[model samples]
Target: MKHTKVKDLLNSTKPVDDVLVKGWVRTFRNNQFIALNDGSIIHNIQCVVDFENTPADTLKRITTGAAVAIKGDLVESKGAGQKYEVQVKNLEILGDSDAEKFPMQPKKHSLEFLRENAHLRVRTNVFGAVMRVRSVLSFAIHQYFQEKGFVYVNTPIITGSDAEGAGEMFQVTSFPLNNAPLNEEGNIDYKQDFFGKETNLTVSGQLEAETFAMALGQVYTFGPTFRAENSNTSRHLAEFWMVEPEVAFNDLDANMDLAEDFIQYVIKYTLDKCEDDLKFLDQRLTDEEKQKPQAERSEMSLLNKLQFVLENNFKRVSYTEAIDILKNSKPNKNKKFNYIIEEWGADLQSEHERYLVEKHFKSPVILFDYPANIKAFYMRLNDDNKTVRAMDILFPGIGEIVGGSQREERLDVLQQKITELGIDEKELWWYLDTRRFGTAVHSGFGLGFERLVLFVTGMTNIRDVIPFPRTPQNAEF
Candidate 1:
């Protein structure tokens, strides 16, 4: 007999005979009732067992975390919470879990505790809902691009150019660290490295995606990106995924529009598709916040927060305007901010971003025309020569969810920027070719996928959204 998914049976309109269900036992109650879950849905299907007829030895094996199959009659649940229940006629234990040793038992767990037990975290309700929503969001991302006829481009994972120009990329080398071959300059000879040149896990796929955008007209890269930054903040993840979409003949405004629309579409799609999971997360967040001080808690629930993004247009403001607003804001005036905004050229921090979104604008915000010195080299230079055609999308809780810019198409200006930054010209010859050969106006943006998931799932920490998080010193399953 085909094994019936718990999700499908829970939605059944009528009774079914001898339905087979296989799942890990969530809990065994009264030696007669079992809560079984297969991760197909957030809720578990109760399986009523025949304790009188069943052997006591077999009954002892139906412990939490144990894998079991039940052949039962699906009937209307007598319990108040669920709609359906299974009257088990046959039971078989496929695998027995040591109840004493299983890390993920039915209980409230700290996020840090679950992080330590990531391999088994999904067995918990919180991780299950988060991961389910994550899967739906990922599908929505690809679906959003594919439906729009955008070419899906797979950029090289090992790349030579630092797209962000942040110098925080993790170096990739096959040579043993201590025994690397050296040249006369007393530096490791990268020419002898695996790629015949120094390479690192890509920080961004924007540069490579731009090359494809020139030919394919529109292209996007959804892949893993790495940053070697050692920041231990909840929002920072050394290894995360990025969604980079590049479009030819697109100016900065068009880039901003594409980003806003793409994000809203995927987010809306996820919200619609993962209703149950999102609801679970919303309740989970509400429950978690009850322990926090009122001032520190989120003003809106997760569902409302997501709906707010979908309902409102992102307020577009320039960097100078944002600086002015932040400078006069209560935090800056009262010296409440950790990093006060004193001038125009300083980069905005998360606190400032949240202030703009949740306090000032009370909506999603987009601040454009950032200082050239602070942005990457690829951004198009403005007439003022001090700012670039760059923009960032800031959300209420998650600051700077998206970063993008109108790419510099002029070879001379780009080379000048590269030279001024002391970047190796020889290394970026291929990227320069796009400008050299028919580089029309082009623009693109990169959305941190994990950050998006964090926002959509109402997860405060970026690590909680991704399955296996790789931090500065911690890389475990």
Candidate 2:
């Protein structure tokens, strides 16, 4: 028999048609109504099952969260709230779930408890919405780059260089830890390791992607990256996905434009394609009505601002300008800040980032040309010799979703920066060779896919945005 998705059944104009729908039961209301969803839509179709009319044998087989196939005739019902209903003719139990043991219930569950049940959280409405938005946002990323003549390049997960140059790396080896290569001092020798030298999971794919961009003109890498930083923040994870797009012959301004356009594309796509999911998230997770305190109004206001951002252009500002605005604010404001937003050279924390984009700017902000000392080594130095051509796109709530810069094309300057930054020049011969062979001006940015998903889905935690998130102290399936 042909199967009809539950969502299609609900959205159809003809309700009185024969339909077959299968899904795990969300809840059975009053033993008469069954709300079933196949993870196909934000809303579930309510299958009105009259237990009195349903065969006694079939009724006995049904349970909450159980996989069931129902052959039914859809009917238009003028119920109190529903637009359509299903009249069941036959019920087949595909699988039975013990209601008592299942993690989800009709009542609300805390996000923390749901985190512990990563495998089962998708069955919940909030998580299902997150996964759906995550999917559309990812598709939009590929769509934006492909339309702009950018070739999709897959970079290696294992690497010899740290693109972020942050020094957080995870080692890879075929040998067991107990019997690995030893040095003269009897320590585990990285020189004689499996890859014949020190190697670790790549922190970012920017450097390798830059090589491809120089050849292909424009290339983007979308893949997994690892960091062994042991950070346990709600935003940091051990393993996550990133999209790094590098373009040749681009400067800091071009880099900022690309970042802004790419973000606008994703936001517009998610708003257009995942309307139902976004509405669901906006209602349940980010609604002002759901906040517990009046002080939390700004948090909800940020959501409205994000929605408005889709229809508006982002604001561009230099680091110096942002600092001046912060310095000018009154010493005592109505809303005290969690972290101070200071002068140009200081790193912008999340609190400062949120305030700039969400409250002060009231729109998305692109802060460019960060101080060279605080940024990575590959960034091109401005003529002033103080600032680097680095750019960060700060979104409300998420803060710095994209970090990028124009690469130093001059071999001498790059080599000098490498040495000054304490990075080994010999280890990056292939990277430097891009300059030797015929280097062109290039720029790229790495957008943390999880953070993008959180921004798109209105999810408050990075853990909820990623499936089976690999955070510190948690690797369970």
Candidate 3:
């Protein structure tokens, strides 16, 4: 018999005579009702069995986390929770899971406990919903860019240069740990390495994406990026995916427009396509918040928060204005902020960003014109020479969901900035070549895919949204 997915079976209008369903058993309750899920959707289909006629050995094997195939008749469910169910006539245990051995039982598990068991955590409702939403959000990103005639570029994962100029990078080498080749000066000889130079996993695809954008007109790269930052916070990940779009002839204004539109479109796509998963996550968040104090609770539900983002325009504020607002704010004046905003050139911390987005603006904020010294070298320098045409899109929960800026197209200015930052000029000759030949005003931004997923799924920790999170001192699967 052909297998029918639980999603299709549940949405079926007419009853089927015979159906074969194969999935992992979520629960076998009362030795009669079996909850089965095949990762097709968030909800599981109930399979009612005739326990009296069934063998005792077969019933014993129908435990949580057990994989099974059941041949049954499809019929409308009379149960309170679901719409349809399978009346099991035959059952085969494809894989048996001992109830005492399986870590995920038919009960709620803490997010931290689930993180430890990352490989099997998706079987649970929360992880399943989050993963599904993450998949849909990825598709939406491709869809939005493709529809706009933007070419999708797959940038190299291993590179010989640091795109972000951040010194923290995971070195990719083939040398033996204890027997590495050394030069006459006792320095590690990278020339003897595989790439004939020092190489590391790419931190961002924006620099490479810009090369394609100049020729292809507009290009976007969605791929894995690695960072060696040792920060073990809820927001930082050693390995994460980045969605970067580089557009030609785009200034700061056009870049902001693209960022705003892209964010809202992808979020709306998830809200429309992953209705069931979003609903489950929404309820999950609401239940979790009940344990916290009234003051710490969220002002809006998950669904309501998503809708609010779509319905309202993000508040656009300049860095100078934001600094002014923060300096005069009660937190800074009362010495409540850990990093007080006392000067104009001071970088805004997460606490300051949250206050602007959550407390002051009460909306998603797009902060632009950041101080030049605080931003990357590639950001366009303003005429005043004090700030850059950089922007960061800050969400209510996530501090900075998207960071991008207009590129410094002028060859001399870019080279000077590179020199000023002490970046190796010889290492980035290829990137500099883009400016040497017909450089036009181009802009791009890097959106941390996990952070976006964290925001959309209402997951608090950055680790929860990503599968097999790699953090400092914790790479266990």
Candidate 4:
């Protein structure tokens, strides 16, 4: 059956003779007013039912979560909440829902409870707004990259090499776990596997995308990546999406510019396109902030925090400079930091990064020239040889949103790094060839998609931003 979306119908300029809208029932108020939604938007369209004329059996089926088709006349809404609604002329129950058993009732549900019912949580206003904002943000990402003339490339999911060298990778195997083939050393013989070699789920697409950048000049990979870390923190997930863009002939300065501009553009795009959903989330956040202590509450509202990013220029500082600032910061000096910055080359924790962005700089900061020892082996080594041309864009609430560097284009320096890190050189033979052939100065960054969504939606937990979060011992739908 042909039906108009509730979103379009709600924004109608004038009345319509007959309109059909099929959606799930949100609520049946007094058996006279029906709140129906088809997932076109967060708000439900009100359908006023003529309960006096409708059959008792048909009216009883109009329960929450039930699927129904409403044929009605569209006109101005006398209701306070919505602008326009439907005057139901006919109502047909397409699918019946048991009122006693429907998990998503008309009452408010806690985030934890909603997580358990993840499949049905989208029926709620908050999740509906979040997922809708997520969809628009995804589209904005692609639109921004496409406008910049970047080639969208799909990288392999299974790989024989670890891009980050973190050693937290999920192994892929077809052999029996108990009786896998073994060599003389009694280790599992990878050659007997289905792929004829050991492989694991890819951690990052940066390594593969770099090869394409050499040929295409600018390329990006936006796809799922996996990690095997056992942490169950609100900030981590076993499986998540990554957006890695590699550009040839782009140095550290160009890379930083791209990251800032790209973030601002996509955020503005989402703000413009998903105004209704974002406004809903903004209010949701404001209410949530009310529950917190006065000292802990955010100074700016959600929308203001977003506008802050768009209006201000991200402050650029070297890693050494950040370390110096943190050394004298009140948190570090007063022993309030969990991981104190004692000296240079010290690894900065989330608290430290946040202090630099939220407190010290008082704006988004792009920290560059990080110590080479703390970064991956692929980043280029500076002439002083102590640090690399690396940078991380730090947001106010989010610590490190984007991590990237000017890749080491010199074959010898890269080889030395690979050897120093004890990584098997043969596994990255193809990646190495990118430098051997036509490599010039190149740079790129990897942004966690969930982190971006979390920042945009004002969601505290990383799990809440993604539809189905894969975490330690919890993979339930």
Error of 1 at 330 (Å): 1.7
**TM-score against truth, every candidate:** 0.99, 0.95, 0.98, 0.99
Q: Model 4 off-target regions past 4 Å?
A: none
What's each prediction's clash count? 0, 0, 0, 0
Q: lDDT tens digits, residues 1-477, model 3?
A: 789998999889989988999999998899999999999998899999999999999999999999999999998889898878999999999999989989999888888999999999999989999999999999999999999999999999999888877789999999998999999999999999999899999999888899999999999999999999999999999999999999999999999999999999999999999999999899989998998999889988999889878988999999999999999999899999999887899988889998998899998999999999888999999999989999999988668889999999999999999999999899899999999999999999999999999999999999999989999999897
Each candidate's lDDT (Cα)? 0.93, 0.84, 0.93, 0.93
Model 2, 95-159: lDDT tens per residue?
A: 98888898888778889999999899999998998898889888999999999999999899999
**What TM-score does candidate 2 reach?**
0.95
**Which of 1 and 2 is ahead in lDDT?**
1
Q: State residue 207's C-alpha deviation in candidate 2, in Å.
A: 0.7
